[model samples]
Target: MEVETNNNNSYLSVVRRSSRRTSFPTLQGLYVSLFEGEITSDGLDLSISNKNTGKEFNPKLLKITFFLSIFISTVLCLDHGFVSCNLEYIEKSFGVGYAQSSFIGSMVYMGFLIGCLLTGLFLPVLKSKVLLIGSLIFVVFSGIYSSKSLTLTEIYASRFFSGFFQAFSIVYLPLWVEKFSPQSSTTTWLAYQQLFSMVGVFFGYLLGGILTCFTAEDINIYYMSSSEKLSSLFISWRGPFIIQSALIIPIILILIFIPGEILDVGDQEQLSEIEYSKTTGLLVSGVDLRRSTNNNLLPDENNLNKRNSKLRRSSVLLIPSQSNNPNSSKSLEIREICSNPIFMFSTFAVCGVYCFTTCTLFWLNQYFVEVIKVDRITSVFSVACIYLSGPTLGVYIGGITGDLINDYHPNGFGFILTLCTIFSFIGFITSMVVAQTHPYISFFWGMIIILFFLTSTLPMSLIVIMKSVSSKTRQLASAIAQFSFNFVGFLLSPVIIGIIMDIIEYFPFGALKRRYNPIEVGIKIMLYISLPTFFFYSLATLCSYFNCLISPKITQKKIIIANQIDIPKQLFIK
Candidate 1:
């Protein structure tokens, strides 16, 4: 018998000669194929024997899980958009000033920040589904409680819990999605997940608008007296909470349908490896291979003696690699992340961006009503249009561009974000100029145009943060970005904007006095504050480029790992 064992050889053909007859067998293959025992052939049909042990790939199961997780998570995001839009109505209902009323929205974000921090710490210990279900339950109860709140404190408390639950949904849901998806498709799946989230935002706004409009009309239609109508309209704000609560029931039921087996990340990884092995006609299961080392292989006697000496010499680099180790290098990584100059700068940028965005949105409705003298319906519609255009289209566009840039070139995503920031500055400047010199129509239209581009940065910032940070640290990264951006805005918005308005009110000097209209003054302050966003983005772009150059060692390590796992061509075939 003749046997061939060479990497470059295309086929392995064996011929056996016995006293009675000659036998031949052919095995066509690529790459390595480990086999045991001898083969004999007699110029006839050859039978090749091999054991099969591995998991099967189920594409259908993957798709179903991805879709359901995204849908459920997006429901919470929708609620966020709805609550943000209804802040004005909420303020009027509770008889609070704009600053205090802004708390209703800001409190929710605060809760979200806390939830994200907690979830990130606890996720590895807790099952993903348990966290998701727990969050959903919190949301349902919060939504129901919010509808019944009579006092501002009670409302704020409900919103805080609602925000907390929403935060859990945001952080954990994507992690769950990433757990199930193939590595090659991780970015694509994440992008689609974000796309659905934007859709949820669109729907949330639509639902909030619909509820507010109908409730207002119903109040007018049912109550003949003006005072009675006003009283009835006051209660209309609760309608959205009720509707949103009702919408969540079906989502809960859908969550139940998702298979629990698919939710385990470790199990999925093992299964993926097993499936790859099986498809390539391998006889060894990945799990078995892992076990074989521990179960059957004995430590070399000489190697065992040398282990102590090696341990002493390599103790500096031999630290335990367990993911849960509190004292592990990951802690150092976290410290490094915290100390990162780019991260600090980006946090400030995020704060500035969110503050301006939130402040503008919060005040625009009132501005339309009081200064521009537009009807409530027109103001609401205009405000909705401004928000709706960016998040809906801009998020998807941003996510796609981010993925494309990351895939093709290092730091390209940062360039895209910088461009977005530049556009935001341009938009803000144009809006300010228009507000100063143009007619109400010109001002309104110009502001709308500017707001569209300004809001586009929301998604761009999200993508930028995701690109800059590693996957393991993304939760904290997102939390820091969201918290700093939002908290600064929350703290400064009411005070700074209030002070600006107060200045315009008390001073009334030269150009400032001439533009003493509260709405115009608000717009002017927004315009001035918005200039920093451009500066920050410019800084981010430069930082990202430098970080990329300085981080060559990390990139080189990843490339080395990638090359080592060349992903055998035979494994890819049927």
Candidate 2:
């Protein structure tokens, strides 16, 4: 009897041991699942082992690194603004026709587009720091070379190299900002980045204008040969480039101090997927349960069990089936943007705005001197006012307004953009009318008000574009938008405006001559062209409205989410 009892106890103990082992495996699986989800919030804690080993990165340090990167990148954008202001002087020195002079600006933009293409393709292989440092070196060298150049072609070549290098730095800066920012802060970071860019433009115009004030007066000291004129021109042009070249040293130093990893396309894709999943879960959770219940009656327990089994099997298959190759997904995104009507419309609208704005800004100093009857000093100061006040105030106001509208309504950007278009139209008309009729003081103030409103539209347009597209495409889109502006300003504006001036000069009415005020011709041309621009912008407003309506649905379909562990293998694993 005692032997039989002891055997029974051993059998029960063995059964209990088996049950505990089985439960342990289940609990271990649950812990692993929870760990994967939890670690996703902290990118630095990617490795489970590293979580306990490394010192925590302070958030403030990250923020500083991001802001400094933006500031450095933005400093290069000043090149365009400064060069644009100096075009007349440059033309005088090179003895180039207006059409040829336009190439000086256009070649830079051509280089910018090529640089963007190169960076987009090669950034994954090269580090951001290396690209930035290389770009800065190029800019510095280009500046020094430009100061020594006598020929139009030589200057163009220098500007092209400078622009090409600057483009890489500019494109990568925003990309890096996006990479380092918390997911929810993308727009905010973008806004601030753009703000710094505008600030750069403001300072560029101011400094360029100030430097021009001290330009060696063109004393008619005729020398024996053409070489003398060329030599003097070199000395005059050298100053601006020298100043610009000196500015790059501080920017390089600032960039060297920033700490962060360069973003690869694969990493961005993974992040995009993670964000998409979270959004997808929210959408799934929002389904109306009552409506679902009304559509189907309850089944018997066995049938329900069978249905659940089928659902589990289908979900398992679907999840893996839905998994996309990161490269393929990026390609699809690019294709979608190209095919998308909203993107097309937005691109067109941006192109138009850039063309008009750049023309206005580029010729503003000329307009002030000829039409407004301001002294060179006063005109330069006025140009400075427009550049500094308009963009600086505009960005601050636009950013605040965008944040408010985004918080309260889904279609806010559309409305804001429409408002901006309307403001631009009104401002353009007011400036034209004021120039024609108002007292000098009144006209000046009116022009200032008009410019402020017109400039305000710039940030609104930028924010609208940023909000309309996926984050993955935002940098590329911004680059394209900027490229359109540069292309129009450099290649199209000078030629088109020059043609208008030429026609006015030889008009059948015999109203103007070669000695007629070029500045007056410029202002009149601006007024006339603005009428058509106003109409185009109004059409853009309508397009933006339609885009806002469909954007949510389109965005919903493209979003995806996945665990961080899945992200590494899917995105970064070779």
Candidate 3:
């Protein structure tokens, strides 16, 4: 049971140990496993194909988790879509201005940032399944409360709780989905995760628009006169919140039945049941197969003793490797993630993309109503529907391209992301200029162009970041990235634009005497945010290029731990 290494080679070798050491023993920083790929002495390749695996494992669980992850992700973003879609309605009901309305959207993201940070503290100590369910329950209550809120303050409180719970789901969903997915298709699963999130955005808008139309009819105001004020006293914005709350029911129930922790091959009890032939080899006639094989292989006692002694020295692991301590886990992971320029820059790129996306979704419908002179219902429906097409195609296109490119080159994701950013920037300029055209022309062509480019960044950035780090740090890698995107981009974009719109009005007494059209200048300024995203994404690609340039340095420092091993302090993975 020894790892065979050619002394002539400077790199570490991956070899099979005898049956005695097949199961990895957890020590600290060296037991990273559950990922499907071979780590050659040269490097860790994310593209390694495990063909026999498809034939070996059941397809049913993968399908279940795949759809489940998507559904859950959609549920998480519903609040964003629902609230943003009805921002105009919400403001009318409470008699609030653009800045105050922006706070309505920002509150949810405020919850998101706090929740993400909270996970960084508690995820290591809590069971992810339990945490996910608890978060959903919290979401259910928070949403129902929002539906009943009579004031903006009450709604803000409700939205914060909703975002907080939603963050836990974000933290839990990716890791759980990855754990339950086939090793060969981890990136694909993650891609679909983002795809379904976009689906939530669409549904949020659809449900919000539909509810608005239905409730408007109830109050006998299908389309108010242009001269009349928005009468939210009669119109029901409550329906969308209620509908969003209702959607969580199915996600929670489906997740309840999801299969328990995936049993690994290293686990003795599960391994015995799955590998009948291997167990038979070990227990036949009560004889120890490994011992018998070792006796036959070794010439004498001295040789066996020397081999065992070498393994004992080389494999001994120190407990609670300093890197694995609970108190330091988050700080260490964050530090490691920040230090990697590719991860750091790609994360910023991701944040910029989200900022552009949320601002567009929040403003586009209102923009059409104001600038293009489109009808309220038509504007809402068109904007939401147009927004839907890009993400549906973008996620699939970006994800598939990334997976394919990674097969040939390690930096393919960064390359694809950079391209996406560049294209989206072009789309943004086109959309801004085309606003002078017919509303239908801009809605059908310009909106789709801009959205498709912007939405593609998420799945690509996600896959690239996950691949850049070790498995030990994947959760925090994802969490930190989400934190960045949500905090700076998602949380602030609406408020930033809203504040700009407010500044344009210049109410010395902080009163808004106007409607949506007055903010067209602010909307135009927000369009420029995509420009910075291009710079960040291009820099991410540059970092990735250098990452590949120093491939030998990277590989030489690489260590892939398949099983846990005890060792001295001097024996870190590097």
Candidate 4:
């Protein structure tokens, strides 16, 4: 058996070299990736044998997690609290009104959109570590500079620059994690990566509130009411930005410690060992046939051939060669993405949900203070606590479910996504109503419920996008999809909400100052967008369940290549 195994390896190595002659250039080269086991606690062997039953502390995974945590937290938190918690402070400092502040608020997003698009454009040439470090430096310095801005123009320029650079880190984060993640842990780790950013956003808000509460000075620079002077309400808005910027220095150190280029990530998974037999025909599962190439194995196969033959039975699907086939590179072809129904429908769903989500988050703190009649500090802290708790639970549950679905066809995800969308819509409406009706006492609970239901699906949506495309194009696909959803949906949502609020002002009771009801009405109206979002997701569910996401044949026969080991090329053709 050992002799046969060595023979198989030699034969497969030849096939691999030959295949490379025909592999696509889009992937740059034929890098055969394998999945490796994670390190376990007790300094145990990193193997599949133990199955990690003891819940070992994996040092490698821990290191990766810690690195991502710092990376994401530092990048995301750059502007997290700036627009959300301190817009009023910005307004006061610049002596600007709502319109100017809102435009200022949008500058960061604009920069992010530009950055996301840029990532996809230059992905082929971009080195992950260099790009990330450069972006982090840009954002960190920009953030610190923004803290010292004396005018609205300075703030605008600084925020845009910070957001633009932050985009590189954000765009690259998932791709790198996806690259390094073992198959067993990929889905969950992706969720955790997202979890890190989500946590950072909440922490930014919390940190801002804390700094505000503790750092408010007796000398009031901006005009302040007695309550404002005491409540950390009027001053010290710059403290959070400075602290977050300073904290980023440590993250850069962590980044520097991570070895290798960004794109050089892959996992190694063990397959069932191959053994040759002369009596019985070669057994097949997902094993590569080249592993059974030994001539010395039992003189003849039991059934396959009375006379020994070089070819062995293959089960695992074969990947196309990189340069040999013109169509191989088309696997990541842009036209394929645009023409696919599953991608289009799923993208629509993502855009809708992201729109509503971004809009709601932008206004949540203000809603609590102005409409719910909660104290500003309580509003910030309460929202922070809810975020800290709800998102972690939601994202993990969603991620776990996503991993489990690999057992089913890619279309199987549609059903889960559909259910998630429905739950999100219903939960959002209920939460909105509850917040409006109960205002203070029960609003927190309702929000917690809402976030759990809505956010639980967030990770799945991402998983859906990742699963929809080939591994080679995953980063580009993700960057494009995110850009489309965020740029279109997020950009519109805030503008739409603002318009609704402005129109409400025309009524005898429009502004919050005049009547709190407009804010409530506007929020409720915005929530209605979920209807169409659910509609599209439901359509996606149906499309996927029916196995309907196949792309058009560019006269190129498309076959479903899975994340598996090498197999005979003839066996995989459609």
* Predicted structure with the largest lDDT when compared to the true one: 3
> Which should have the higher lDDT, number 1 or number 3?
3
TM-score of each: 0.66, 0.69, 0.73, 0.70
Off by over 4 Å in 2: 1-57, 182-188, 217-235, 262-266, 270-332, 410-412, 435-439, 489-491, 502-517, 528-537, 544-574
Number of backbone-clashing residue pairs for each candidate, in the order shown:
5, 3, 9, 18
- lDDT by residue (471-522, candidate 2, tens digit) is 4455555566556656654457666786666566566766766557655766
Root-mean-square deviation (CA) per prediction: 14.3, 13.5, 10.0, 10.0
Q: What is the C-alpha local distance difference test score of candidate 2?
A: 0.53
C-alpha positional error of residue 522 in candidate 4 after TM-score superposition, expressed in Å: 3.4
* Local distance difference test, each candidate: 0.53, 0.53, 0.61, 0.55
> For residue 536, what is the lDDT in candidate 2?
53
TM-score of 1: 0.66
Tens-digit per-residue lDDT, 1-574, candidate 3: 3332222212221222211112221212322122112222122111211222223445777577667767788877876786788778767667677889989988988998989888765665566667777888889999888876766678889989988888988877666554555544666777888888888888888777766775543222333453222334223566666666778888778767765453121122223223332211211011112111111232334544454443332222212223334587667656666676666777887787788778877887787787778888888778777778876787778777766655544323445556656766675676567555555675567667766777676777777666655344566666777788888988888898888787756766545535434557656666677777777887877654554344333323424333433221122222
Give the Cα error of residue 326 in candidate 3, in Å: 5.2
> Ten consecutive residues with minimal summed lDDT in candidate 3?
284-293
- Per-residue lDDT tens digits for candidate 4, residues 386-448, read 776777688888878777764342223555666666766776576557645654757777767
Expressed as tens digits, the lDDT of each residue in 434-465 for candidate 1 is 65753556766666566556555654565545
Locate the minimum summed-lDDT window of 10 residues in model 1. Answer: 24-33
